[model samples]
Target: MSPTPEAVDLSQQRALADWLPGRLAAEQPAILVLGDVMLDGWWSGSIERLCREAPAPVVDVQNRESVPGGAANTAMNLAALGARVSVAGIIGTDDAGMDLRNQLVAAGIDVTYLLDHPDMVTTTKIRISSGGQVMLRIDDSARSVPAEALAELAASVRSAVEHQHAVMVCDYGTGVLADPVRRGLVDALAGRDRAEPGVRPLLVVDSHDPRPWAPLRPDLVTPNAQETARMLDLRLPEGQERVAEVSRHADALLEATGAGAVVVTLDRDGTVLLRPDGVTHRTWARPAAEKQASGAGDTFVAALTLARSAGLPLTASLDLAQAAADVVVHQPGTSVCSTAQLSRYLKAFADTALEAGELERQLELHRAQDQRIVLTNGCFDVLHSGHTRYLNQAKQLGDILVVALNSDESVRRLKGAGRPINAVADRAAVVAALSCVDYVTVFDTPTAAPLIRQLRPEVYAKGGDYTPEMLAETPAVEEYGGRVAILDYVADRSTTAVVNKIRDGEGAVQTN
Candidate 1:
């Protein structure tokens, strides 16, 4: 599979930042989560002594926390991303089940379909931690749903699927994926596929026994390295040709399962997405030396499902999902990532609204809309009223205003080391946030002349202080039938003066 040329980076994050909020607010995607629902309980304390009888560390419990686990965690993740979420799963008629349902409801998830069975015990995984490390774990649960409960659960899922845009089956070796229920869901999805055609609800399966889901022909299948290896009955590949090997394995899995796409998560090595359209996208994991990976996989699937349901492209969805997982894995204990957390994460990384390559593509897209592109270059290190006024006037000269910012290295080379108190990323983010700027990109050159020629904007703009003859990029602008427009700056409004006054311990003064 050939990878898409425009890799997802800060540019993609900006687009998502704009696209996701609106989509989430205006056209929320409803999703149904069906599978095993468990409660994850944790006890953290300090350990200073060992047990006299058993020779085990004795942890004096100080605090305890409970969170939704298993498939319920996936539902929580979806709600955290602002998706309209409902969960359909089985739990025991016990305190753990009640706690799990309460947490899910508190997270704004619809838990009406979560049924309780008298005979079955709710799956509970309890961890005892001391000094920030897990000392021991005790598990209490039943893996299988009562035979009599399967029919009712299946009926609930079938009814729920009709109203949702997607259905995610999270089978964690639980009997929730019983043959009868699985078959009913598959038929329901098949009917949806036929009735709605292109807009049918997506069927996504993340299961340990992936082969059972093969006949269902799910739209997407997510399997980890070990799960993928076990399902395909093959040894995991390492080093040198790992990418190719994993890609090949993913292809075989897709073929075997009849899934439209397969995502094989390679732990810290990152994730690989394979689509039958012959597009393969791979994203690296964010740096984390120490992390608690509990519930990270569920977070990944939830984000990916929501992004795809909101109509984002496959590559963008993959990148965003991976980013969400990255945020959760770095936190302590089992955690769910909120939309605000994701936005902050992306903003920090992609300071500039666009990268150079992304800027080029965005320009082309604008040109297609018959929008006139106005170009300007500046340090924009410390935005003052003068800069804002100049940018606003420049925007009026054309339909779209593109700002080319100088990189930190270039600024240091030209304006001395003391210049640019803010880094390039911060400067770019500040400029891009302005309403007058249509796009912002950082260039690593002494002058904008080279970039000017490449962009070939319709109108090249500058402040009144610089005449056409003194500017190095004038000729390049003229070469593309683009004339220079020098707008008057706000008098006495200079960033240098602002800095000087602050350094001199002067009082605040109006510059513009």
Candidate 2:
């Protein structure tokens, strides 16, 4: 249960970010993500231009996009976290479903489980925004995959789990985790058929059911404070008694669910973690923006899976998740956190190419490396100690740290005119050249949420003043049992400072 090298964060603005890489180095055994597969779409533009054709502001159109949602997100996260992903979820035989499956395959997640049921409309959630402010939201998806499809999915997952390092059962409560199929998925991983004994395949379950938990006895189950309370049926407050009770409840819950360990995330208070090794701990998130929590939990649990698969102990796994979560929850829209983005908040690991031109290629190349992916994004205008510390720390979160830099266009849209002082290529290189960075790409969105969701790193990271509970990435990161948190800020170190000093020409400091 002790924190391993991967979880050790040199930045310590919050939790350890060192364990990420080693934790993600595992073979990324073919993971069977059996659950929801969805599409998350977003429309971004300016309110100033609403609809010129109507009385509404002429909303200047920026762009439209989509990524995996629900169980699919879980699958993508697994892939990002360095696991060879083979997802089994039903999608309609429509364009959206096709897009979802295609994206998963393109991102390196096996789509063997992505069933195309003609009766269903692929699950999708669309969010529209302008100038960093969310203006509207849309939901277009079904509650469940077809019954027959679910049964087939169960069989597919059962077979995949045989060869997988672990089977992640992502129950989003959205039809995907139907009681019947969900239970079957867990049992399959538990070696019910006496299939491949001694392998002790890990069963990672992320769901809203306390009753179902015990029946499956998964290796690990991640639940937020509120969800923990509901699942454990406790009214415990935040205190020693609460910790003890929560642990006991979690233990009982663990026993009931047959899970080996329980990691309960306590938002701002960091995380109240429990491990089978008889250890418990708490960690904090970095200080960051406090707005829409689109994809925090997904990032957190994703990090955990990656860390665990990479051989990181529970302590290191939790620590890495906390730090990664800190990085993701501070943005305005559905965001993402790449290993590179979180890398600044990680450790002084290895660096990767981050130029805009090389990003896509880098992504493809890394996708071929057979490693879990930890993704995070940011502007990184002027590199600073905090940034380096964060990057190095993030490297510990997964095997391959991919940083998503803001494209020149994205910078202009997000930071306003004259933004991204460092062009996409320059910014990418600056971040990529750092020993801590792995791979770098360009994202033209306000936040890395979308990219994080797509990349679905094992852990998502951010830098700021928030605790784990206070961390914005909490809910989303935890959704798929991923952990989230902020990295300790580098005290007074900041890119803004360097920028100011240089602008004044009275600065005595060095520039990257």
For model 1, residues 1-512, the per-residue Cα lDDT tens digits are: 11121211222333334444345434568999999888888889998999999988889999999888889989988898888999998888888988888888888899888888898799988999987778888998885679878887877766778878888999988677698888888777777768778766877888876778888778889888888878778787773145567777666778877798998887676677777766566655664666444888899899889877876556557767877888898888778888888777656544655777778888999899988999999888666657766786687677778999888888888778687766777677656644456688888877898898888899999996778888899999889789998888567887777667656756554532
| Model 2 CA RMSD to the hidden true structure, in angstroms | 17.9
Error of 2 at 376 (Å): 32
Give the per-residue lDDT digits (tens) of candidate 2, residues 206-290: 7776457566667788877777777666676973345557777655766655677777766654566676555555454544655
lDDT of 1 at 374: 93
Model 1: runs farther than 4 Å from truth? 1-22, 193-198, 239-241, 352-512
Residue 89 in candidate 2, Cα distance off native in Å: 0.7
* Per-candidate total of colliding backbone pairs: 0, 119
TM-scores, each model vs. reference: 0.68, 0.60
Q: What is the lDDT of residue 51 in candidate 1?
A: 92
Best candidate per TM-score, number?
1
- Ten residues in sequence with the least summed lDDT for candidate 1: 1-10
